[model samples]
Target: MEGQLDHHPTPLGNWLEDLFAKLFYQPDDEICKKAMKEEMSPQLKVCINGQHVPREGFDQVITEARRTYNISVQNSRELLASPDATDKGIGSVAHIQTFTLEDKKTGNQRKQTSLTISVIAFSDGGKQLIELVEIVLDH
Candidate 1:
């Protein structure tokens, strides 16, 4: 039952949830850096709003988010999970995230969106590390 879904933090599902909480909701740079270093594969691919973002472009996305949104994320809830049939180790989850953003000179704005996050867990030195992340914007 090593890969069983009955576990409290079903390997792939739990890790993906935590990753999104840190990257999108909390916005912790150090944690994000560490997660990327330790969890993600070197050939990671990320897509947002239907556009593919090469691994190297991740920093730019982070920078843009910081500049445009100064956001505080709240009410993050995992809505659904879809496990991959072809790969038992892969899973995807739909999450509802709520957040508020403020521009010091402008005003405050609140928004909520559903995001689908997909993760692939693969063995690296006997430890399962997340090798792929495919994030989809759910409108």
Candidate 2:
């Protein structure tokens, strides 16, 4: 933790809420899709349960989830956040949450509570974005 910033912030709630809403309910909205691009880095790295995944694959999962299930956020927590070393007031944010995914076509459901930690930063165009994320889940 020596190199990490000390601040803890959860200001991305609105952004997260919007992401889920648009991702699940409005997948075809051009404006929303355009805006969503600004929220994550093009070179984003995601590790779910210790398995690395590419950005394209990540987006596929989102698409699959949108088409296959109705996801409900049963519980959530903003564990921590810190600013970048440049003091631009951006760094990483962590959240732990339980989600209920009800199958869209089959009516089956599942819970996979997960802990997600993401490093956020300003892109070259001054847009806030998630660059790297690590996810651990309890099934």
| Candidate number of the best lDDT | 2
> Model 2, range 1-139, lDDT digits (tens) per residue?
8985554445553345355456554546564456557676778787877788898887777767777887777876666665442355466666667878888888988887767776666785754556546564547
The C-alpha local distance difference test score for the whole of candidate 1 amounts to: 0.57
Instruction: Please give the TM-score that candidate 1 achieves against the real structure.
Output: 0.62
lDDT of 1 by residue, 74-130 (tens): 666555566551346455555556666666457766564546565555645322333
Candidate 1 global Cα RMSD:
6.4
Predict model 2's lDDT versus the native. 0.65
TM-score of each: 0.62, 0.73
Clashes of each: 0, 0
lDDT, each prediction: 0.57, 0.65
Clashes of 1: 0
Superposed by TM-score, candidate 2 places the C-alpha of residue 69 at a distance from the truth, in angstroms, of 0.5
